[model samples]
Target: METNRQDFLKKFNEAFATSDVDFILTAVSDDILWTIAGDKVIQGKDQFASSLHEMASPEPMKLKIRHLITHGKEAAVEGTMTTPNGKTYSFCDIYTFNGFKDAQIKEMKSYVVEEH
Candidate 1:
């Protein structure tokens, strides 16, 4: 079960760079709340989907995950994403799952900083 959750989180984080909206949505709950630190907060699947589309780029970003930690119903992922234009951003996302088994992300808080 631990390994399963870890694999799930890996794919979920990678979905962001791949623009795989459907996969992301499926991994989250219907009433999911996403807070992008210093940016904006998104609630519900509809808003989440809209935000995903708005942030989607023509060329997929490259993601390099540094760490992934999970315990109980909480998880955190740290990574750097490099855009097609050569810009890189370091990000750490904290997540809360709906349950321990067959979990779906119910809340997420993201802290992202652009690399100079």
Candidate 2:
């Protein structure tokens, strides 16, 4: 059986891959704080969906997950998102999940890094 965090991350990735805003919100807390690269911060599910739509608009040439690690209440993921324009953005994202109940994520804090 997968851990709650692992399950959440898997579902989150699936939602992202398909641009499913509703599914994303189901896994994310209502007050989740999502910080993207380049100083963009999104709060709440609505804002997350909007920001994600804008970010995902570039078209998925490819999105690859390089690594994922979890420690206590925190997790980090490294990945590359290649846009339709042929721009590859390598990123590392750190996340903190507050709690889990019924396998649902209660809160989260995300930090992002972009490759130079």
> In candidate 2, what are the lDDT values of residues 28-83, reduced to their tens digit?
66777876556867887778767877756534346688777777767777777665
Candidate 1 residue spans exceeding 4 A from truth: none
TM for candidate 1 is: 0.96
* TM-scores for candidates 1 onward, in order: 0.96, 0.72
Consecutive 10-residue window with the lowest summed lDDT within model 1: 1-10
List clashing residue pairs in candidate 2.
none
Clashing pairs in 1: none
lDDT of 2: 0.65
Best-fitting candidate, measured by lDDT?
Answer: 1
